[model samples]
Target: MASSTSHQNSLPLPIFSGENYDFWSIKMKTYFMSQDLWDIVDKGFTTTENPSVEQLRQERKEKQRDANALYAIQQAVDDANFSRIMGASTAKEAWDWLKEEFQGTAKVRSIKLQTMRRELENLKMKDSEIIKDYYSRLKGVVNQLRAYGENISETRVVEKILISLTEKYDPVVTAIENSSDISQLSVTELIGSLEAFEKDWVAGMILH
Candidate 1:
């Protein structure tokens, strides 16, 4: 039991620092589940007016679990974030408070999601940007959309990239479209092909 406790403590917790609450909450929930503490944290603990010996023992066990869950949450947040939940007496209360404060209301999330969608639609690869750098920029928006519950498929992402590249890539894009099924191509494969074409293009210019 001592060794088991040590092993559990050795696992790292995702520290929340007010940003990316969606990602942090997902990680924290998985951590709580791994520790077998999510149930108490999610549903909270209840007490009965009158209880038998077994019931009392079970209640004590649950109380201990709740305390453990609360402590884990306290440890997983920074000092600034800690103050937000300082007044919470139960793990469930702390969790819910953080969710409400950071995740915002459903309407706020919908508005934010719409803004992200607009950003994605307007994204384009700059003529001066390398394939990897442009892909990184595109991926950041894609991840934000996904974290906010958008269903963005790889094929959709691939198509978006194909249309967003600068005119210098038109020849390679044409070749790719002609030779391969765009729907079947992975982002990594497309990026690899574009990067190879870019290297040759650069070398040809240097030779001239």
Candidate 2:
């Protein structure tokens, strides 16, 4: 019986081309590789470009520096905005907050060991960047409240006043957008129109 079994035919294994072999090899390669693996490159070498701790640290530092810089810009703008919106009421409260939280771009540019900003020139971030981020933050708050089925806070009541003031500043933006009309209206006339708008809106509010 053992001799008979030894004489039995074995099945023929199919031959694979170099391309097919490469394809299968690649498929297997992915399975055997670690997350950090660059490739099983050159038949198993240093294996991957595992960043050195210092490199990792430098990356982290750069990220934090950028974050701090953007944050500083945002806080500075927000604080200035808060003061403008709060008018006389924001004096003590806003000053303390600013001292604690709002670092100007210049100061952020000066942060030690940071790569965020340097030279007063780079510190001059575009006005569009500030306005974009400001509106984004404002939109985010509105979205959050809507999503949560929540009402705006008293804090946001103040924000509403600021939003109104910001809206009132629109004529200048329009003039800038359409350069021909910049001098068509005096600043006094603009202010007077805004005051009149406030009066009418207030009267409507009372009547309703």
Candidate 3:
């Protein structure tokens, strides 16, 4: 088997941070699955009481996979989180530990929820900010809210846009609400329509 240490040393990105755990988790899981190490982390390797030669070889493969998985995980976390999982004997153990540390606690969830709620409430589309930039900011907050287990619907997001945007967006908002089913509209479509209006508005200004 290839040395897991080599793979660990060449991480494409830096370790995960608490604030970006949701994105980091998805990326890391994809990496593990691509490398075929996720199986060891998902279902531990079992060995027979009296192993045959082939069984021993299989056991060795499982052990190597576990080691590689652990190494990959260690590279994706900070020293503090590393310390929490350092004592884990298998990749599954380390994975479970990290999940619990980051996701299992109500305290963590509450803190994350509070922070996202505050950001959403205060979110505004700045006059200088382009439509794409403004929508990106809103989408980011919504994604974070979902990551923390909040069920934020598209209608709520549309409402946020209507309430938070500047006067320039008011006409677009009115047209959208009056002409379209807000609940049926995806956030992407809403952003695209508003961006089109912004382009027209800019063109009109240039012509004048």
Name the best candidate (by lDDT).
1
User: Residue-wise lDDT of candidate 2 within 107-170, one digit each (tens)?
Assistant: 5424521332122112222333333344455454444333323455444423332333455445
Q: How do these models rank on lDDT, best leading?
A: 1, 3, 2
Model 3 earns a TM-score of: 0.67
**How many backbone clashes are present in model 1?**
0
The TM-score that candidate 1 achieves is: 0.83
Model 3 RMSD vs true structure: 4.5
Query: What TM-score goes with each of the models?
Result: 0.83, 0.18, 0.67
Q: Stretches of candidate 2 above 4 Å error?
A: 1-180
Q: What are the runs in model 3 whose C-alpha is more than 4 Å off? A: 1-19, 31-68, 75-84, 96-104
Please write out the lDDT profile of model 3 over residues 10-79, one tens digit for every residue: 6575487666777777678778877787788878677788899999998988898788888788877888
On TM-score, the leading prediction is: 1
lDDT of 1 by residue, 177-202 (tens): 99999889999999999999999999
> Order the candidates by TM-score, highest first — what do you get?
1, 3, 2
